[model samples]
Target: MAPLEYLRPSDEGAAIALAEADGRACLLAGGTDVVGLLKDGVLAPSRLVDINALPIAGVEIRDGGLSIGALTRLSDVADHPAVRGRFPALAHAVLAAASPQLRNMATVGGSLLQRTRCGYFRDPVTPCNKRAPGTGCSAIDGEHRLHAILGGSDRCIAVHPSDPAVALLALDAVVRTRGSRKERAIPVDDLYLLPGSTPERETLLEHGELIVAVELPATSFAARSCYLKVRERASFEFALVSAAVALDVRGGVIRTARVALGGVAPRPWRARAAEAVLRGSRMTEATIAAAASAAVRDARPREQNAFKVELVRRVLTRVLATAGAGG
Candidate 1:
């Protein structure tokens, strides 16, 4: 690792100013992913703006919703009483991520802002368009068994590797951020940008913007939701296919539904078509399969990853069934 200037900003305004001044400055939160980038030589920022001193590390209820600080550790958020009680899907998603040690050090914002787990992007020697624009995407022809099936373009096929964001998408969470220009809020689903022509740009955040917090609406779905992650190993592994399902079933009929998928898209994918299929319908094997099919109907899979379409359908079906059963 190269020696870099360390800065401790007293306020968000100062932090934003510093970040704007240095184009290569990287925000230092939990140092989980940033340190990995530093060690791997993928990113060598000229300055490190340590935001750990900022007052952004708590979980609270405000305006009838849950507001989680960006600096809150993943372990803390997962084990939070309100989260586990009201948003079990979010809790389960956070708990299912990485290993215990990594979760302990990973922050909520950092978890969502983590880079793609694609081997080509991580390898500095590889010609990855995400790492360097116009260099070309190697994963399109290389080992892409774990690549995306949806929201992929010719420029890039790398999938977003955030587990919690998938559940947040199902819960319709809102992301709040502060940039040098002003503060703004965006839907959790909208924060991620698809890799169309600009594979280098992964998020909608401006140059000096920093994630402040994420707000989850106080809805019934939060209580009756569950997350299902299918990975190669029992632990310490990214998902091959993950489903987050939230259903509001009443009198043997689903009144409302929220579904999102992970490990199969450039962003945390929300299956609104599947939700539409479930609304006002009774939970049945056939209905679940139909909704699952609708969820992956638009998926564009490559040769090695063609199985992901069916795998996501099965995962969605199983997760929806579990959510309906109040599991």
Candidate 2:
């Protein structure tokens, strides 16, 4: 392991300044993914700035919606009464991440900023585009059953490993970020960048930028939302296919709908075509099947992961039916 200097900043500005000063400095919150990266030798930061002392931790209801601070633990977010009552899909996604101990230690911002769980990328010896740009992606011709089927380019195909992000995309959540330049609000769905030419650039955040909080709108579909994750094992396993659906059906007709997919894309893939199919349509089996089909119409899966197309369709259909039927 590389010897690293640890700095604890008293305020958010100082933390941002330290990050801006040191080009190789990394922010540490909860140390869930950062610790793993350091241990695996995937990242060798010159310094680690601990943001635990920052006052960016809270779960409050404001502006007729929910505002969750960045440093809030996953366990706390999942167990919050308001989150469970209003955003069941988001809560379920949070609860379904990692293990109990990990969820207890992982922060909301850290979870969103977590790197890919690709075997090739995790191993420092492997040539991964995400880890070292221009080295080429090993998963292209290697073991890529867990790789992305959507939003992938020739350079990279690693799937994003965030369950909460998929749920947030369905819920239309907004991300609030702060930096040395200024503060800005970004849609949760727009925060991620597709691996086109630069595979190393994961998000749109700048050098000294930090996620401050996530704001969720108070939508009527919140009460009728669901998150379905399918994996090889029940617990302590990443999703092979996951679907998050939020439906606002009124008198047998759908007024609004949101659908997002995970474990099959470089980012949280929103099914806007599926939403278009559901809007103003009756909640029926045929309608649900059509919506599911629309969700994966443009999916481009690799040779080994072709089954993900069907798996994503099935998960979307089931989740849409369950959420629409109030089950």
Candidate 3:
């Protein structure tokens, strides 16, 4: 570990300015991910700007939609009545994350901004393009059983590790942020960046930009949604393949559908092709099978992670069925 200064800002602007002034300063919200990185020597910031005192830690109903403060705990969001009743997928995704203790300390913003669990990236001694650009990606030809199959390039192939992010992508959530320049709203789909050549830049967030809240628009499909995660164990483990599905079914046909996959891509992947196959289609085994096949049509699985191609298809089929049944 490295010696660092800690400062708590009285306001959002002050926090952003403090971070912007020092290029190596890092914002600390829940300290779940940032602390771990610091201890592991993955990050050595000159200063830690504590933003826990900021007035941004609650769930609110905003004009028929939902707004979750960035500092809000994952456990609180999971247990919120509005989240459970309206955005079931979001609630389930939070519950399906880390254990109860971690959920209590992990904030919504921290979860979205959490780094990948790729062993190469976490170990400073290893060669990982994400951790140090220009260095080779060890996972490419090494142990990549948990690497990405979709949206991967020769530069890197590490899967993202956030269950709630997948649900947020499916719900079309927008992340609200306040930066050194101005406040802006970014779509959840646009928040992540692929590891094309700059694997070091994981997200689209600008330097010194702080996530304030997440806005989820009220949609008919949001209520009838489901999240399914397949992991090696029942607790304290990351997903091998996961799917979040939202369907608005009228009469017997699907009206609107939202499909997102995790643990098989560098980011929370939106299966637009699968959604296109489901719209106006009857909720049946045949329809789900076709949609599932379409979801993995473009998958470029590696040697060790090739099983993920079939695993994601099965998971998507089950999640879509679950969401459709709820409707």
Judged by lDDT, which candidate is best? 3
The parts of candidate 2 lying over 4 Å away from their true place are none
Candidate 3 residues lying further than 4 Å off, grouped into runs, are: none
Worst 10 residues of 2 by lDDT: 318-327
Question: Could you tell which candidate, 1 or 2, scores higher by TM-score?
Answer: 2
Tens-place lDDT digits, model 2, residues 194-214? 999998999999987889899
- Candidate RMSDs in Å, in order, are 1.0, 0.9, 0.8
Mark the 10 consecutive residues where model 3 has the least summed lDDT: 318-327
Point out the higher-scoring one by lDDT: 2 or 3.
3
lDDT of 1 by residue, 141-171 (tens): 9999999999999999999999999999999
Pull out the clashing pairs in model 3.
none
**TM-scores for all predictions:** 0.98, 0.98, 0.99
For each candidate, the alpha-carbon lDDT, in order, equals 0.92, 0.91, 0.93
